[model samples]
Target: MWRCPLGLLLLLSLAGHVALGAKQGRVRRELAPGLHLRGIRDAGGRYCQEQDLCCRGRADDCALPYLGAICYCDLFCNRTVSDCCPDFWDFCLGVPPPFPPIQGCMHGGRIYPVLGTYWDNCNRCWQAGNHSAFWGMTLDEGIRYRLGTIRPSSLVMNMHEIYTVLNPGEVLPTAFEASEKWPNLIHEPLDQGNCAGSWAFSTAAVASDRVSIHSLGHMTPVLSPQNLLSCDTHQQQGCRGGRLDGAWWFLRRRGVVSDHCYPFSGRERDEAGPAPPCMMHSRAMGRGKRQATARCPNSHVNNNDIYQVTPVYRLGSNDKEIMKELMENGPVQALMEVHEDFFLYKGGIYSHTPVSLGRPERYRRHGTHSVKITGWGEETLPDGRTLKYWTAANSWGPAWGERGHFRIVRGVNECDIESFVLGVWGRVGMEDMGYH
Candidate 1:
């Protein structure tokens, strides 16, 4: 199977030259599904650029350096004629190609325009009239439909004080991920869906990981965003949108249960009104502590343990400080500015898409969103430049991003990610681990 589309994949493409080169090619090849190659003057239906890309039988033991993935090429082994480039699925996978053959707007071979618009090589499918850049949203859905975190009225934190406490001089690795360090404790990202309550989802997510870490694996609970959505009503709007401060406030004061106890019901809730009714509630047991007063909504769990966290603290937009916090503590909640193009992110280090920049105001429209920043790292682009980025977990579920996580440029506050970072400690005590 081809790991990626067969292409020259030159260093120039790293500088956004892939599209330019594809336009110059004479032939096209459907190298891999969606991994279309406008080619370096090659076609999709043609053989590999090099005879070496073709190999006989399994590629693992083939010992070919230039060939990236297994592409069958032989006539003597199975007693049948075979070419690696032809019918990729029939020879290798033993199944027909998954997609039905459709008359595609042929590129390179000629500029064949199916409609008013022509396919741009290594570019997006374009059409006349209104179009959407974001995958699931309409072109005119505006920015508010999916994004839902209000930027803190003031992201201004005491940078001087924070730097002193975090100790700016600490030597940090070039990269780090809380998931790798903590393993199962770092919860997989969750989908916030139609509801814009990223404030709730991210808050709950960070709390979930921090608590699990602080407890040393004794209490790894997936805290409930639904718990906050319905009950944390002071200056909060549940699914429609809410404040990060308010979310942290609830996790500290009112507290919440596990997602198993109170699953998210806001995905399909009416955006015009309040969230679904609060399913779990708590009563103060004593000493300013609270206990769940009802059974888990999912009766099978037989648990209604209330999870609580400490008041949140801000991580000023210092890259080192943010990295130190994530390494020492756990995931932290970060407010990100999500533009329309952000919805179309498949993979790779994300900066604002170049096509969406400048011009009309709406083309650049964006909304604030809160995401969980789990780690940070740097990428070396072909241009010999090092780009640092933060690995952030979006609330859009495992299917939507790099398995529900995306990397934004780390320093210079790309999209305001580090502008207002917040961290909280899980209020774990002996009772949480069942000692009491």
Candidate 2:
């Protein structure tokens, strides 16, 4: 399986030779159903002269370790793969390459840069035409379609008023983390599975934190993303993806039940599907179907007042303002872009590093991912300049990215994270009723 049609190509590249055969023209072929190939002119595909690079699954043998995959020419080749590497899924799943490929990345003052590695089986598919499970499209396309398509929320908070009230530049603390302050109130990192509903999960998670913090731990209830996924369908798609702001709007008006009542079903499917029907608060209305009802019995009470976000407001593009909000209120929801390089991030403050031989843009599409911004900190640079970063709580489980959290370059709107931040005040179910 490690064998490839790259012997001739590698010899040519090594000898600094150009194609002289008739293998140079637009030839079409079908790799699988719905996956047609066109414009592949050469038998060796494309060539590059980079000595440090390697293909998706090729051997890399050089004195100094090489950088991650880079795109040299039309083909994403490295020194070891000879020339013309297959696509990620084809290379790994279709042919089962002979050797496993290891990639190199940089992080906080690490010299050798081999600090860690992870099992990237998330996109490994053996079935034909099923490359990465990211909505049957390239990684970038999936992200862009799910996140970049959503329109910004209509409700806007008065940034001037908020800054004036909070005093944005008021010598804020160097670091802050919501998990440390309200450890019990904050939920563990979640996994959304193959569904593109991080928007829903992140929104729900942040709302839960707000309710818990606002009520001083007396009303720490885990809100259900399932509730929003099934019930809130006004201006957004349910599981296929939705807008962060629109989700907040739904929470403000129609609130959600606890996870105990309706647990999340995000990881239940491999393909994107319509939101499942709300079953917890609904009763069977004949024909084996359930109809949604407002009231549902809780463990201690039959009362039926949906938990709500008093008001949802946007936190504009100000890092200090965002920090102040988190320090004062609680966690806030953020819609950030996920580039191809982000999936490779393991630890430390993350910044994008392009893999030139990979043609990353062609393989992965840009995606807008929603996460909860829990805190912020500043790392002093060697030149005495300060590098500010934001601590984000992800919904992809603790196994990924800094133990369910990631630190991204902040203050500069890295990944456009600071562009559309949102916050809200949650209403506890029994706080007003004097029920501790």
Candidate 3:
């Protein structure tokens, strides 16, 4: 009887030891290539206890916290962090590790750095830090610098007074409309906020617009700028103010789609479309679903070239004439000093000078200000400031008041204002001009 009991006790102890060994073995197995396990010891000096692994190099890069453990060894393990971190990893390797745990979110299978902005459902505006790289440049240089890689050739030729002539009733069948009559007329509205990929947004917008006009019809529906700005997984500069042309190349290679399809706010249940299962994060949704496969749209354009332009009118001494000529002829992108007064007038105002055009008093009284000039118009404000104004568009979106359109007071007889119009023009290759 004594021998039988002893044997039973021995068997129990052996089983317990095996169980402990199994647990330790599992942890050791997890510490594969590029990972070194560091075991902590107790006061007794014998391995007191918990075992942990310090990931090294490639494994460390793969073990980015934003993507979870799966991404560490799988998709990102072999690839350089530069390629994977652009749209995913929020934490910088060189920066000190954050004390309070940083939270991460996903959009379109890619992780985005969420620091300052509140994620809203309706108006998905992300508050991002200003990247100083984009400042200080002539409009031409800025566009060129931003579109460094994919240079386009076919330039959109604008005649002086095109904006004025295109307005309502001023000139029927304006150049834009006349171009529509031609065999190649491509025009499309680009959705601006979808992906925070402005480079793609602008590039695709310009390309598709030109292509529609030149190849298919007059203008195609506006391509969504939202997709370019928001959906790209390879770059993170969009919401922080990125270029437009670079986005086109990214989308061409990686492809993009609806934000609703990839919820970045931990609201996957609220996703509208079917989930893509083939992506790296698909397993998070659960098993049994087919893997999601990314599909590029057929409308993507691939040509990259440069174009040249001839001066329609040499700028003369008259600043007003120069401004008018630029407004009429080309889509001159410019950067101007913004003042509080410029934001005045909620909607309409009269100004002797363009500087005073958006005076706060006028904006408060009329509830509108014009930042962009399309053409000239005459309007009578409620404040009795009857002034001839130039039609302008605002970057403030449709909900901000004027449905994305506004007017600026270019000049009045009393105030001989000298408004600056920065002109940008270059020839792009005919093939570079994709569908509008």
Candidate 4:
């Protein structure tokens, strides 16, 4: 009995709307003469069924009842998501919710208003808080996951003795860069991706620079970190993480082929995932030299010749001494603590800020990582404040942080970057350079 009355009312309302539209020459605006209204973002469910509630045109009165609210399914809903359904993107558009959505993180029935910043490790989700397990949508998350560095200890710490002073009274420059002096001889930075193998990356990078600088540009090979990650198995856990001591040991003894030969394959989903098997091997050629026993793992690149390095030695934490060693030798490796805010670094003089100090202790995690210190500089702020910083090459690739480099506060052992600095020499001989 009641159905007839309700049906008649709906028909009359729709007819009046059409008659008005005919008089107005068309729907004056987007509000069609329908019997419904717009809605807000939907709850996580299947609400967008275009066949039923979908509007024939730009109808604001096209929506579905969902969880005590309306879920919009019309073209007008796309213009203003104040009335959009959560599942509209999935059910209607068949796509991930666009980043920086109408809201921030919606997680575990809670709305996080920070917008793509909260990285939930347990759920492996992100951005509007509905991301995939493998990727993130925030600038802080960047392109990939970062790895943990081995903690500092005697195993990875050392100092170089002054056998004889090169120049005791010479005044050092306020700034210096190895790349500026060496130019094309110094190779650019490389990417480590998600692997916890910075121990290998920094070690191999320092050795590559020293060898190239010492050889006077004759043997400028980008030595392979993949070589150490795969083959240096003495108390080292490959992608799981390792100490620089073990990496330097492998470079001095077993040696490694060029990056063009071995190539890195440690970007698996697991930060500590198993590294690929050693595809290339080397045999001692006597006189502290070696030769590759097989072709390069990357068959396309044929330069599989083995390269070795001399012993690794640590430098004094005194800024002057470290500077001299770097200018005379090449880029040196430094072990430092990486805090959560370190990942947010883009440019300018970087000192560990206290911004994250207020966060819960669990969220204030830090890790030890290694990098190549190629140079140093000082900056004067507008307020006449002077800042000193070390220029370093990060393994996160050229797209990040001053084209793959970062400047951290120097001299006072900020992040302990100066505490565990190291230097090494490449074992390049005249004959090894393919010349007489």
lDDT tens digits, residue span 171-191, model 1: 799989998999999999887
Top-scoring candidate (lDDT): 4
lDDT of 3 by residue, 142-253 (tens): 2222222221123411223323223354432211222223323323222232222234333443433333333334223333344444544353343334532244344333
TM-score, per-candidate, Cα-based: 0.68, 0.63, 0.31, 0.68
RMSD (CA, Å), each prediction: 13.0, 13.0, 25.3, 13.9
lDDT by residue (166-215, candidate 4, tens digit) is: 47669889999998999987779888876768889988899999999998
Candidate 1's error at 71, in angstroms? 34
Clashing pairs in 4: 39-83, 40-83, 40-84, 41-84, 42-85, 42-86, 149-368, 158-314, 159-314
Off by over 4 Å in 1: 1-136, 139-142, 155-161, 164-169, 269-274, 433-436
Candidate 3 achieves a global lDDT of 0.29
What C-alpha lDDT, on a 0 to 100 scale, does residue 215 get in candidate 4? 87
User: What is candidate 2's CA lDDT for residue 169?
Assistant: 54
What would you estimate as the lDDT of candidate 4? 0.66
Model 4 poorest ten-residue lDDT run? 1-10
TM-score-better candidate, 2 vs 4: 4
Per-prediction backbone clash count: 8, 15, 72, 9
